[model samples]
Target: MTSKPPLLASMFAPWPRIPIDTTDGSDFFHLDRVAGSAATGWALGPEGAYEQNLTLAEVVDGAVREALLHLLELGLIDIDSDRLNAAPGLPTHRERAVP
Candidate 1:
């Protein structure tokens, strides 16, 4: 049987991470919004959901940088679909990449 190329959705889903609102400005990027902000120093982004940030500006910036690094080093290419598919005879994209 032949396999398929992994789709981006399966591996990740859309979720809120930082609680920052440029319009509000007052709230800024409150870490409290993040589910596990106190523990992980990260936010509950697409990779995770309700099951889950940084400062107003610094925190948000840092989070984005970190996420980008993960994608680059891990080779996590974005896909348009909602299902995460993988190439045959290869390890899962997320698993292969490391922090």
Candidate 2:
């Protein structure tokens, strides 16, 4: 009488498929398909084979963040913390009503 592993635990079990390479020589884990599969629950690989969308979201998110940080390090993008933190004042209607 062995207890079954949790569904989430099983869902995250090691990925069984190997990544295919693109014609341009990039490794194809199909990031776009995988990301979309979070809502669809299925992804099509480069070979047109269906795959279960699992921990790939975390992988894709980390990859995107790494790419953005790399771009920032290269000075290709700017981050204005002050602008991001600045709060917009009250709505025009509220401000007029207050006065």
- Measured over all alpha carbons after superposition, the RMSD of each candidate to the real structure, in angstroms, is 16.0, 22.5
Runs with alpha carbons beyond 4 Å of true place in candidate 2:
1-54, 87-99
Which one wins on lDDT? 2
Clashing pairs in 2: none
Model 1 poorest ten-residue lDDT run: 90-99
lDDT of 2: 0.40
In model 1, what is the error at residue 85, expressed in angstroms? Answer: 30
Per-residue lDDT of 2-98 in model 1, one digit per residue for the tens?
A: 2443333432443223323434333323322332242234445442322322345665555655655554454543453433234223222333222
Per-prediction TM-score, please? Answer: 0.26, 0.32
Residue 50 of model 2, lDDT score: 36
